[model samples]
Target chain A: MESLVLKDISITLGQNLVFDKLSLEFNKKVNTSIIGPGGSGKTTICKILNGDLKYNGSILINGIEIGESNNYLLEKYVGVVLNNSYNKNSLVIDELFAGLDTCNLDYEEEEKRVKKVVKYFKLQDILEKRISSFTIQKKYYIKIIKELIRGCAYIVLDDIFINMDLKEVKRIISYCKQENITIINITSEMEYVLETDNLVVLYNKNVAMVGSTIECLKEEKLLRRLGFNLPFLVDLSIQLGYYGLINKVIIDDRKMIDAIWK
Target chain B: MEIILQDIVCNSTKADKCLNKVNYTFKENSINFCSGLSGRLLRDLLTLKKQRESGYIFVNPNGRLSDIGYVGNNPLKEFTCKTVAEQMLYFKDNYHLKYNNVQEKIKSALLMVGLDESYLSRVITSLSTSELKKVSLACVLFYNPQVLIVDYFEKGLNYKDIEYFKKLFKKLKIKYNRNIIICSDNISNYLDILDEYVIFNNGVLEVKGTNKELYNNVIYKYIEEPHIIKFINLVRKKKGVELDNYIDIKELIKAIYRDVENK
Candidate 1:
């Protein structure tokens, strides 16, 4: 199984010791939510994984020191797809696909991969249009497809769904699950946390709590202390769970109601 | 100002009509939500990357561009000042306000957005995403325009920030009688705050009504049903229980509790 490990990571930003001796491990094929308020080093962690930031201590994928490797070697070894928002004025669909396969020497293979992804996303109509001209939902779909073409088992989205419709967000989550992509959402949105496989709560530059979704959902006190805006459905479902209307905190509205009825 | 958009057709750069004769009246002092605006109309509403085509957009007391306060989805890019204090003074100076008592005005403006005086010295680049959003809103609110248009209103706000905004928007609506127009995809977050919703699907005006009226009217592309409404719907559909349309979870629980007791 694929796994990413951060051992004894420490980073200093100006006067703030943002991540001192921070350690964590993420196993493959399990989507995780890194939930935290602003200034909790969540984006910094994403930056470090994307080889954009220099930090002390070792970052390992399959037990290789990623921090010490050169960019050329790191490109082949690291496959974590970083969520980079498309430059609207500069990007069209074909250009975006070409940009994604930058490391490809085989043109035909890249073309095939692009075709497969385009078919999967049903991007026939607006493939030639400037991405900026498309709706916000279509833009999100394009970005996700571009990232998936990178052939990464590990996907990290750095708060990309802030402006997305909730239904589109759900579609992305379901798509990730179906494709067996180990997606990591680094966000401050509380509504997003309930849908993940695991929850990593970061507060004040440290791991406040890390557990399965069920285990973390019960940590309402910790969520409150971390100053997260708990989702309405999650709060209501938990309350109903206390009253025996639910056995687990079901994040899906229909499923939760079905559980209650059953 | 009461803004009227009649046959307001907006076109993308490629000359595709996105807003197909959208007609709506944004009444003064009302909190209106314009959801699912196409890229073209969305841009024209915020005066961004696109322009409007053959249409009539009439607004009284809005002769100058400064009369419409549009805080965009990502307003952080518009911040050119080094620090929050400078940013505040920059907006104040635009209104021809003197340097005297500028510090007091800046402080009060930051406070109105739930930002502390400490942020005055903080670098604009160093501010968090949420803080940047608030500062942008503060600068726009400082202008106190006749109509306030917040594009993607709840993009980066947490619950506490949203709660703070709810109170502030209420004050603006009730006391100052300022027309606040918010455009977002989801209405669930603004369940309690919004007065009415005007939906824009694809390029046309689909519906303009209250939350209750629009709940069952699911012809639009992006309309979020409140959790209570959805839950009550499930109970009614499955268990044959007739529950009145309750918007709050507490009220739904009370009705559910009564039903269980009677059973």
Candidate 2:
């Protein structure tokens, strides 16, 4: 029942104020997505979560202050895979096991973890392939696998799904959910938000909206005003609602067609 | 300008060649979208940034090579200068363009890309990813080419920026009568604006057709169909209602409304 909480967070880069006195909470074991316009501080929040940037307020992971916690504690609680590129020369196997080398796990335990993750993801074939040889989707898969092996409770995906198809992204997210890992996805792609359990909308350097994924999406007007276009189905349902055809956001094609006909 | 490729074999050294004997034509003043993992390679080859392993590319209206402007995916890496003005100056010098007023030329190019004179002195390293992309695009616009090539519209760009670029590209195509070729892995990004679709998979040309043509063709087997297409298809198959294939959300909404009202 651990939760990731932020309180009175304020940060600025150079002359621009990115986030101002922002506060939010990510319920553990819940897959959450953060979305906003460009320069709206989505990446800044990811950096704060990973302890990569200096900020004014407190970030609490399972009631431990992130600022005071050591790297060991932070690593145990959170794992981050930013959208930035990985070293092209590194092999997949080496990338997967590099984090575990710091975990103090026994050699046998490390192998067991690596083997389980590789088998789970069906990544056994690409273990020897260099990162450069793999496609964008495969590279992200390797990064997620590496984090899975390290055994972090919460994994932050920073808009890495832009290049990946919706089906592929859903498969990976569903698998992570099955593994009982909290997935916090920071993204600009509104389509990916439909897959997460919770949704956080940031706008003008503050939290604009936060609620269950579908509920937040139902506020189509606010989403648009904040410089975000709702996903196709959601937008369709909203328009249909205006015409007195459908009542709620219908993401599935069959269900939506059924609603219109019914 | 029209670009025709004959038996194009690119990136031959790689296990999966980016293009395998691909024969395609990018029509004049048309929007072409090359979608797949090897899209970057295809774009590089089209822009002459990289040499093809083996191929015969025929660009109609000779001297089209100088007329093709390319904006790559990673804009930060596309620059070598310290500031925006310096970069623009270097491009002007490198291209050896005869600009009567260098300052006026720089200002106009930046303005075209939605930036202004204030951005000229800004350091390239300090600019945001979106700004860098704008600057990269400005560098290309400085040349005022007849054909424009842009790569990866979605990566590092937000919804607003993508929409802006989409509108800008459409203006360049329609108003200016310029040919545009966009290379992206996700076809959904340019589904509405694109006139033709050239899909590649593992360095092989899977299919090439107009948006409407490919919607009913076997293109679905290679790439994920847009949600609007999927919805339209479902309505056609299950409910026996034929809806026009509309990529734009607003148009699709209206079509759905009309269909529901008729029902």
Evaluated on CA atoms against the true complex, candidate 1 attains a DockQ of 0.41
Error of 1 at A10 (Å): 3.1
- Candidate 2 CAPRI-style tier: medium
Error of 1 at B36 (Å): 2.3
In model 2, the runs with Cα more than 4 Å from the true position are: A68-71, B13-17, B37-40, B46-49, B64-66
lDDT of 1 at B99: 50
Cα shift from native, residue A133, model 2 (Å) = 0.7
User: Which one is best on TM-score?
Assistant: 2
Segments of candidate 1 deviating more than 4 angstroms = A71-85, A89-93, A165-180, A252-255, A258-262, B13-17, B38-51, B62-64, B98-100, B211-214
Candidate 1 per-residue lDDT, tens place, B29-63, comes to 88887776632244356443455676777776554
Write the residue-wise lDDT of candidate 2 on A130-168 in tens digits: 987776667777777787778778888888887676666
Q: Interface RMSD for each candidate model?
A: 3.6, 2.3
- In model 2, what lDDT does residue B180 have? 88
Note the Cα lDDT for every prediction shown: 0.71, 0.80
**What is the DockQ for all candidates, taken in turn?**
0.41, 0.55
